[model samples]
Target: MKNLLIGTAVLAMTAGAALAQDVVRLGTEGAYPPYNFLDDNGEVAGFERFLGDELCKRAELTCEWVTNDWDSIIPNLVSGNYDAIIAGMSITPEREEVVAFTQNYTPPSPSSYVGTSDGIDPTTAVIAAQTGTIRAAHVSTMEGATLVEFPSPDETVAAVMGGEADLTLADKDFLIPAVEESGGALVFVGDDIPLGGGIGMAFRQSDPELRDKFDAAVQSMKDDGTLNEMILEHLGANSPTF
Candidate 1:
């Protein structure tokens, strides 16, 4: 009878494992590239794709990619629309109150500055950031400059390009593409300060099991060189670090 009971328990555990292997949906902004963005053909590509693939591999699970607006991704994850979020979000104390984080995937801090003219030094000019974003808080504390808050990064970038705001601040990865796309109308000008010290997978705070699993998978990838390889592939060899 004891052996039969053990057999039943084993079967139940196997069934549970099988149930856990169902389609795990991942959320990304699909707006930021080299991290998570849509290609010309509208297919998902970039660091987020590579990282998500590694996580699914580590967890031995199948996944479906889902595009979401930047602000809605976390709320949707909390609402159970997806299993996890990998949208180049930084781990912060306030965010920790609402969601849990996996291991640090990319290098923690990566900041950059953009100005209308190549001759304008960002540190000495007035800066703008999207309101209600981490970047807004980051730029608001500059010692000798003023921070103009906007509704979006695009607006901040546009302000600089259109000669409204003197500069704009954002994660270097995001800033680079904007600067390049501006065709020298806007130039990057910052002191290469380390901004985000810990980038990680975000999960609802209630989902500790899922968080732990994702965290373990991130650590496994880090141990196996997959994370760094993806970073190098996107950010290049000369990328700044903290």
Candidate 2:
């Protein structure tokens, strides 16, 4: 009888430990606002963060958040540093070769930016954003438009406001804080800008089960208004129409 009781207790303890283990390690560029960003309290807060949290709960698994530089996110995921990526990373056919993608949470929107300068004439000066962003890609192809490539969106905004570049192109989502942080030195060109592709989570090519679980969770969030509430919290009164 004592042996039976001991065996049951051991099994219970083992089961509890297994249940407590985190099932997924989600990586993100915690600097991207409205998508994923760190709050004043040093907690990761954003639309994507909430979605990731919910997905873990829905799948009955533990989820741990990890920070990774945006440029290296995919490589780290591929190397098993994390089980999945929840960055505001866009899903593209190019990336599909290396990793599978969950259904898009943030659909693609046109990349936009604000241009500013004190003394320099916009007609004569070069305006640009960082290299490799869709904005830089588009700006570089314009006739006579010298697109200055900076290291990051923040740098590009500095260049433009400091008269280094006439302007910078960034995702509309990013442009909001950049302008606010710039102390009114910059302004969006117009509200009529057309946007581009959607953003989705990245996973290992061999992990379709995880991807499916995430996709279903996202759909549930979408249907239940959880995703929208998170969007409103991060984006202010004028939340993006998801």
* Top lDDT hit: 1
- Candidate 2 residues 184-212, lDDT tens each? 67777644345446778887665666778
Query: Estimated TM-score per prediction?
Result: 0.81, 0.78
Q: Mark the regions of model 1 whose C-alpha exceeds 4 Å error after superposition.
A: 1-21, 118-126, 143-152, 240-242
Best by TM-score: 1
Model 1: clashing residue pairs?
A: 108-196, 108-197, 109-196
Identify the runs in model 2 with alpha carbons over 4 angstroms from their true place. Answer: 1-21, 117-125, 237-239
